[model samples]
Target: MHDPRVLLDPATDAVRKLARRGYDLDLDALEKLFSRRTATVSATDDARAESNRAAKEVGAAAKRGEDVTAARERARELKARIGELEEQQRALAAELDEFLIGIPNLPSDELPDGSTDDDARLVDTWGEPPAFDFEPADHVDLGERMGILDLARGTKLSGPRFAVLRGAGARLERGLAQYLLETHTERHGYTEFSVPAIVNRPTMTGTGQLPKFEADLFRTGVADRELFLIPTAEVPITNLHAGETLRAEDLPFAYTGHTQCFRSEAGSYGKDTRGLIRQHQFAKVELVRFCLPEQAAEELEVLRGHAETVLRELELAYRVVTLAAGDTGFSARYTYDLEVWLPGQGRYREISSVSDFGTFQARRAGIRTKAKDGTKGFANTLNGSGLPIGRTLVAILEQHQRADGSVRVPEALVPYVRFERINPDGTTS
Candidate 1:
């Protein structure tokens, strides 16, 4: 959420910047809401003052030994009026809050033009897509041939878009997750955390995943409690400091976590419906950071580099692209998506997204930074997928597979998996 003071100020260029994301922020309608709220607040204050005066008048009449019935009755009337005004004030406040929460973070003025992924600006590319003498098979065909992935069983158990990894495929997913967690925590200076896969409504909203994206979430509850399955570790990991204040000395905090993410993939019909490219549930290693507003720019690059480190270590060919305003996530002011080259798909697919949310998420989550002099302000937040395990596994299988149908493990992950390669027979060798 944004600061109401800045958003409501007529002089601010908020409307223009928000337009970059293709969002039409109705300043006139918002002004009316703001004016109404202000009037309601003023009325409440006036009624409170009048009630106080009425109480004093009744007290004086009682002290003078005069009949205080009418005075006391007037006081009671004032009390009732104040109650009505206060209720209005509360209702108006809630209305304003809901309106503000629906608005997305303002896109940075420096962002490239346009709103969709096709309009994103390409930053750089790394390595090269591998050459294959034989026609490259997609992850699904390769996994099935190796007797590792079972899609039919997955569908039978939970319907379409679900996958069951067996034998080497399951091991590969686990190995990839472990390798990513290790690389991030040990070398990237990130503190590893084990977070819950389930979070409450506030926790979900704290990261800007609620209300707007509820349709894409898996909601569950027992009795009267409302809970949601996290779509990514980013949701839980970034909210670790929600409603907390940290000293300026603790300027930047880096955290990493691995979690099983669930998504309804709402409205995504007939898209990547095959294989591990899109799934109802998948594992991912996430990275999150909190820093002073001034440090956000540098933090973004550093965080992106940490995610890139995983790809570099695994020798995966990938490219980085800066997302346009509309393509960026709700809480992110700017984003960099790392698309790994998949020879099987004959194109680059997103495997990680590094974003700098400025103070957008911090304001929503109530994470503040207290300066040495005692002044405080919201902290800036950023997060990225170090790598989504399913996609990474897909890239590995397709990129490193031999013409003979065996898949060679990347050198960096060999130690973790305790094998150099997975044979065509689904045996480790």
Candidate 2:
């Protein structure tokens, strides 16, 4: 959330900055609202002082044995006026908070000025797409042929945009998640955690998933309480220290978690309707970090590398792209998406996204840090999918698929999978 004071500062160019992220600021109305809020606050303060003065006069009159009724009546009137002003101030503050929270984070000045994924700037490419002699099959066809993926049964049980992995497919998904968690914890220095999949409304809002993106969430009621299934482990992991102030020595905190994520895909109708590319329930290894504001830029790059390591270990070809201003996520000031090559689709698809929230989420979640000088400020928060298990599995299946329909397991995952290859006959060799 942006500081409301930014809107009041003409030098900050807050309105123009927010416009770059596709947010239209009603400056005229916002100015008027701020003015009214200011005026109401001043009036409330004055009324409070006047009430106190009037009460003091009544007390002095009573002590002097003089007529105190008139002074008491004046005090009562002043108290009532103060109450009214206080109510108005509360309403104004609420309105201001609503407006501020609805606004998306300001885009970084370095972002390219454009509106879609096409505008994303390519940062780097790793490895090369494998050459295939025979016509390659998409994961949907390969998994179904191997009796691993059951999309038809999934639809019958839940509806469209759902899938079930059986046999090697299920094991592969589990292996990928375990491999990611182990790599992040052991090699990347991330503390591993197991988090809940259901979170309350405040927890969702802390990670910028609530209030604005509620439509993309799966909500349920437990008795009289409303809860939401986490759209990503990022939600739970990032909120772990919400509303806490850490010491300056703990400027940087790293955490990783693996969990099942749920998303409604509300506005995304008829898009990627097949396979594991998009699903209602998917598994992912999430990465989250909390650091001082000054360290955010470097932290984001390091975080991206951690995610890219998964692709490298799996020997997958991939590219990194920095999202354009308009394409960045709501809470992120800047983002880099890792798109892995899927030979089956003959194109690159997003497998993970690393983002620097730059105090935007910290402000909302009340996460702060205290400096040695005793000064306090909001901490910068960052998170990314170390890799979504489904998409990583998708890449592995399509990239390593043999002409005979067998798939070679990546050496890194061989220990966890205990298989060299998944044969066409659904047997491991």
Candidate 3:
């Protein structure tokens, strides 16, 4: 939720800055509510004063032994009127609060404004998309040919947007996550944690996934009142500081966790329907950070590098892009997405989205920090996919396909997978 004070702040300069962030602030509605609240408060004060004065008059009248009943009655009426106004004040405040919750955060001035993909900038490209002498096949086609992906049975069991990863597809997904987790914890300085895939509503809402994106999530209909399957580990990890205050020294706390995210995919009807790109369930190793406001942008670069390092290790080609304002996630003020090249599809696809939320999420979640000077303020939050395992698997199969029809496993994951090639016969070819 945006700070309500900014909506009502009397300073002209402050409002202009707010305007730059694309916030109109509903100043008229705010003014109307403030006027009502102030008037009610003033009326309540007057009522209480009048009641006190009446009681004093009654006491005087009683001392004089006449007209005491009329004065006492007047005080009772004033007290009842004060109670009524107080109730109205509570109602008005509640209404204002509901309105505040619906307003989106103002986009930062640095944000690129456009509804389409134009404002997004591809900042870096790594390795080279392997040039194939023979024609390359898409992941769906390669998976089908190699007996790795089974979409038919996935549909028979779980309906659309689900998959059955057979043989190497399943193994590769697990290998991808393990490889990403170890790389970050062992080399990237993130604390590895195992978090609950089913989390309560507050946990979801705190990370800015709920209320706004609830239709995209799967909630438990029983047991916990408002529990929902986490859409990503980012939700749980980012909420680590929700409703808590951290010390300044804890400025840049990084956490990485793996989760099997569940999504309804209600709006994405037909896009990416062929392969592992879009699914009802997918495993991802998410990276989250709690950093000082000044350090957040720099943290994003380091965070994005952590994701790119996996592709680098796998010897996969990829590029990083800064997402435009309209194309970025709800909670992200600025984002850099890493897309891995898929030779099969003849195009690059997103595997990781590294974002800086600034104080947007921190303010909403009440995630804050106590400064060295003892001043308390919200911490800037950042999160990115260390990598989504399914997409990485897709990229691996598509990018490394050979003319003989077997897919070459990346050198980095071969040890964990215990093989260098995925043959159609379910053996190293």
Among these predicted structures, which one has the highest TM-score? 2
How would you encode candidate 3's per-residue C-alpha lDDT over 230-290 as one tens digit per residue? 8999888888778999998867998999899999988898888888899999989999988
Q: Per-residue lDDT tens digits of candidate 2, residues 1-429?
A: 778677668987877887888898888888888899999999998888888888888888899999988888888889889888988999999998888888888889899888898999999999999999999999999999999999999999999988988999888988888899899999999999999999999899888887999999999979999999999999989899889998877779999999999999999988999899999999999999999989998999999999988899999999999999988999999999999999888999999999999999989998989999999999999999998999999999999999999999999999988888999977888
Model 2: per-residue Cα lDDT at residue 153: 95
lDDT of candidate 1 over 107-187, digit per residue (tens): 887778897789899999999999989998988898999899999999999999999999888888888888888888888
Descending-lDDT candidate ranking: 2, 1, 3
- The TM-score-based order of candidates, best leading, equals 2, 1, 3
Name the lDDT value of residue 84 in candidate 1. Answer: 91
Give the Cα-based TM-score of candidate 3 against the true structure.
0.87
Looking at candidate 1, the ten consecutive residues that score lowest on lDDT are: 3-12
Query: Model 2 — which ten-residue stretch has the worst lDDT?
Result: 1-10
The lDDT per prediction is 0.90, 0.91, 0.82
* Clash totals in order: 0, 0, 0
User: What overall lDDT, based on C-alpha atoms, would model 3 receive against the true structure?
Assistant: 0.82
Residue pairs clashing, model 2: none
Query: Against the hidden reference, what TM-scores do the models get?
Result: 0.96, 0.97, 0.87
